[model samples]
Target chain A: MGTGFLDAFAQEYKQLLDSELRLLVERLDAPSIIKESMIYSLEAGGKRIRPLLLFATLDAFGIDPKNGLPAAAAIEMIHTYSLIHDDLPSMDNDDLRRGKPTNHKVFGDAVAILAGDALLTYSFEVISTLPNEFASADTKLKLVIEMARAAGTEGMVGGQVADMEGEGKKLSLEELDYIHIHKTGKLLKFCVVAGAIMAEASQSQLDHLSAFAHHLGLAFQIQDDILDLTGNQQVIGKPVGSDTANDKSTYPQLLSLEGARAALSNQINQAKEFLKKTGLNTNLLREITDLVASRDH
Target chain B: MGTGFLDAFAQEYKQLLDSELRLLVERLDAPSIIKESMIYSLEAGGKRIRPLLLFATLDAFGIDPKNGLPAAAAIEMIHTYSLIHDDLPSMDNDDLRRGKPTNHKVFGDAVAILAGDALLTYSFEVISTLPNEFASADTKLKLVIEMARAAGTEGMVGGQVADMEGEGKKLSLEELDYIHIHKTGKLLKFCVVAGAIMAEASQSQLDHLSAFAHHLGLAFQIQDDILDLTGNQQVIGKPVGSDTANDKSTYPQLLSLEGARAALSNQINQAKEFLKKTGLNTNLLREITDLVASRDH
Candidate 1:
């Protein structure tokens, strides 16, 4: 079940990221409700895939993954914030995520929305305030710039808006690609690119790593589409077919299930090819790409 | 009617800030609704007090206000985003802002929410990616860290949560101050501290400027509470008594109108004392403080 190195890395990081995240929010000295709402969502937990991707990219670059902890946590906070907002009643109206009641379901829409904002805003603070030992101030600035661009209108939020407007309408493959690329791919690409940036990877190296992430993200999304159709609710955490219920267009819905699976395989292959071109140690990166391509959840 | 220096500076920067802000969003190749929602709130406009404060602080420290344009615009974006979210149905539920329908009323809830998110995220990008001449990466990094701390849970968002939780409870003056300081003071304080930071002012200067901002912010909030009690609907751009109608606490509600006025006067005086201590070219900052203390809308 485990790709030995990847599993070991993830296991070590999950606890570190989790505890660090717990301390970050706990130290806020904020109102109890806001903290509770934030913690509830944070603690409900997911696969920590974004952080792992960040760590893998660092590992591939021969950078110590531990030094990237703040950036790792920052990206995960961003990923988590997006999930919280996406599950809002006005958005997906989702009641469950990660096998737990959504943020809004438990904390009410107002606090949930605020909790999301807090997490999003705090992510930058965590990164921006990192000591020079982690990364130079300039490097941190680049990370912040890249993160904001990826998470802002040109990225996740814009993609979310497009997703909302496109619901109940059949979306073309091009349109779906826009949604997936900006919605999910941009930040995923950021994960790898940020790792490269932190490690002072050259432009050539950054480009290859970015290309790897672009394909990996698409492959991951396609796999998610497949899992929604084929995976059990218990395994997937949320109920299956929720996308269809929300009138969302998925790859499997646009293409046949077999076609979607083929797309996934193609994307994964492209991702691996890019990794190979990076000409760096990519054992963890390759295994994670494989894991993403095959994960049921 | 005008403090000559403050008025000229405000007029100059207001146009520059507004038009620059317009161009920043215009360049974003985002989806229409999201862009529309963001611009609607942004262009609807307000005092632009935050930007003016940024410029005034720079002017005081003998730095080119033009050099601060990106940061000024960034802070305004953050202010606008906070307004958009604060006006959402799930939040303050206001339908009017700057004499126009709120973002949610114009673009619906989801777009409004995402637009706010987009604005907040992009603000950092604006600062982080500023050309090297305007500020160093370390300075930009500091600006981002300060902005996030002021705008995140322990600052505006936390204040917002407290505001929500305290509604209808006839909060004590101390409780009300907590909301005002976190909700309004933090960001206002950032406006000054960020300017000094960018200017590389001496520690003594930064301390005096921070103290000035602290008092000015408290005065500003007190005046807002007063306006909600006595100002015209058309002048204020929103209904008077909405705060009371929502059963929220205010300075006047807790301390009586006369007491609130006395408090506002005291705050303004304290602001001036700090400014006098700075002993820098802070005439513009002092005038702006006076303006905030007396502005009708």
Candidate 2:
């Protein structure tokens, strides 16, 4: 049952993301070099977790998931850009991501960097072009603000900086939480909340979704840590123990494996409780949360 | 008279930019390492050319420049982010910008890269937050599209790629034109067009501003090429002959000094003619055009 939910959700979201990315790239004008660079990494596969959460949140509000596609695409674009830059020779210096040669490795460092920059700027273009299917300008603007906050200084970028600065050093639980929340949690929150905002969900509903997403985000990171430590390279499709090789701190590094497992359980419970309050169909969300905690990779 | 215009314009724009940047940075949530990286470069002094162009265009339309502050700040944020990324060791590898260490040099490559990402994301946030003081949602959305096109694959980034690929190799004038227009011209065009769009200018007015800005952008870049060849480090605040050192093909390299001079003159004439059609307060815009051609650095 869990595998069924994961496979279905992943496939549907991937199809949606692929279509949206193609359409967005098609809208570019004649010059094709930069466009090709951008398309290269964007099409490079990753689990479309962020966009899935966004669409699911919208669906919970009885909103058509199509209404959330632009935001979905924009968040993925930002995510892909971050990955491309992070994998640069001067950064993580990784030559592979998801079992494929990294963007910089394939396109050269200059093209990879420019590709990241282009995608970051193009996300705003996606948000601004969102059709009037939105309930109000105020709501659309709110979604934009939420996304910017999530992606900007106080959010993912901040997290990445903290992670960089903290590498090869032991970090307290509080410090680690700070890094994860900003770096990964914020964008996840934006993914969920942006959908709710687009659908004009009640403030109360939004609050619940925020809580649910926050916990899920933490849970997601913890799982990533676990997979990094123990998963098979063939299944994970990225190098295992790469974090250890870099001397980066992770939940499993800070907390023992048992403690990390306990924390994961706690977070999963919090996500479930928050979702229950929404009184919406959360069967898929619940199953995904379980999958997040239980997946081997 | 022209010198006075240039000095006052530069001074006023600097002041406006300073205040806008302060407000923008102030909005960041408390104490994130990534925000620090962003602020490090954003506050470093550079010519506020893009924001100044935005404000000047707004001023020409009889709009209170304050109404356009969000757009002005947003454009600068985008420009600053591009500069930050461009200076990375993986890209242009410049250690200095505006007489200060580049962000990557001071903050480390990862932080610098993330900082650039933060600023790019924040630019859109600034735009979306424009209160009803600017215009309707449709108009604001239009501005977003214009800015995105200028910054994205088919615009500035595309130009940069062409530039990198064409480096050291001899290039036809058409290819060089392609690089300059897309890389620099597009964003410059956005500065003028976005301002006019916000001011609700007539279609004809927009067309005039567009043409004026197009020529002005090309002229500005050509002037940069000349400065790269002949200007002092103290005056330009960047190393002289850096382009030649990098084996970059510039206008001065592609066209002889005399040819470059004639091209600059022709562009200035075209820009002046376009501004003449607008019949607005042309003094500032006209002086700016002349300054582009005559600037020593």
Predicted structure with the largest DockQ when compared to the true one: 1
Q: lDDT per residue, candidate 1, A1-297, as tens digits?
A: 468878888899999999888888899889989898888888887898888988988888778898878888888889889999989998878898876889999999999999999999999999897779878888989899899999999999888888877889999999999999999999999989988999999999999999999999999899988998889998987778878877889999989999999999999999999999989999999999989987878
For each candidate, what TM-score against the reference?
0.97, 0.93
lDDT of 2 by residue, A27-125 (tens): 887457677778888888677888888877877777777778888899999899889888998788898887789988888888888888888888877
What's model 1's TM-score?
Answer: 0.97
lDDT of 1 by residue, B156-235 (tens): 99999999999878788888999999998999999999899999888999999999999999999999999999998889
Q: What is the per-residue lDDT of model 2 for residues B1-297, given as tens digits with 9 covering 90 to 100?
A: 446866876797788778878778877874556666777888886767787777778778787777877788888888888889889887888898777889988878877887787788888878877887577776766777788889887888888888888887988989988999988899988988998899888999999999999999999988898888889888987789988888878788878877888888889999999999998886667777777888877
> Global lDDT of each model?
0.89, 0.83
Q: Which pairs, if any, clash in model 1?
A: none
Candidate 2, after superposition: displacement of residue B294 in Å? Answer: 1.6
For candidate 1, what is the DockQ-based docking class? high
TM-scores for chain A over all candidates: 0.96, 0.96
